[model samples]
Target: MASRLVAAAASSSSSSASPLARLISRRRLAGGADPHGPAKVNLWQDPMSPSKWKEEHFVLASLSMWGVVMYGGFKIFAGGKKENKNEAVPTQV
Candidate 1:
């Protein structure tokens, strides 16, 4: 009984939406403002850019450095990759 009522309500609401409204709603971004303009781009997404650092730059650099350090620490504590034991090929006669 309750399931029938919920199904009827959902069908009515969905049918009331115009085709254009449904398209617009379906195409909208999940959590951001309306998708009407070009996507935002960082002028200095490249870390090697000559542009001076902003607060975000510092945060990005720190995070990247921390990742490198953490990886190094893991390698040190967990043991690194084993070296190959295969014989080398001759390059010259």
Candidate 2:
């Protein structure tokens, strides 16, 4: 009677295993199921085609341009260092 119970348990265990195996074994491509448009190229690869440049490249370029603009504006508006009149010139011995 124990041997019959063991045999029934083994069969049930195997039948339950197949569905889990099927779920785990599914294959999908990288970047799966997303709607993709035309492939983007590097900014240097196609300088004129801003739309075709990679998103990261566009962001970096935009940030760099803004940094330059801000620095230039600051330099232009900020007054240069002034000399202190209180300091006396050193005399030669």
Candidate 3:
């Protein structure tokens, strides 16, 4: 009975899984998609028709404006706190 118990324990532990199973599972999850698929269609484009360059250009311009606004806000808030020592010096003294 003791030998049977020992054998069962050893079998269970050995059956646990090799590293290859884990590696394969990870690869299968990560490797399926193409990294360079075509860009997504804009809302203005019909699903069946190819997207026009003008529509893409409009979208890019809007995104660029949004980025500029965000950066301008950050710069304003960041630079607003700093006092210019040269401006603070009294020239009339």
The C-alpha lDDT values of all candidates are: 0.64, 0.76, 0.61
Model 3 error, position 64 (Å)? 0.5
TM-score of each: 0.32, 0.52, 0.30
Per-residue alpha-carbon lDDT of candidate 1 for residues 12-51, written as tens digits (9 for 90 to 100): 6777766454333243356676656544335366446525
In angstroms, give how far residue 61 of model 2 lies from its true place.
Answer: 0.5
lDDT of 3 by residue, 33-57 (tens): 8656666665456444445335666
Task: Please report how far candidate 2 places residue 11 from its true position, in Å.
Answer: 13
Q: Number of backbone collisions per candidate, in order?
A: 0, 0, 0
For candidate 3, the 10 contiguous residues with the lowest summed lDDT are 19-28
Tell me, by lDDT, which candidate is best: 2
State residue 9's C-alpha deviation in candidate 2, in Å: 14
Off by over 4 Å in 1: 1-52, 82-93
TM-score of 1: 0.32
Order the candidates by lDDT, highest first — what do you get?
A: 2, 1, 3
Candidate 1 residue 8 C-alpha distance from true site, Å:
51
Best by TM-score, which number? 2
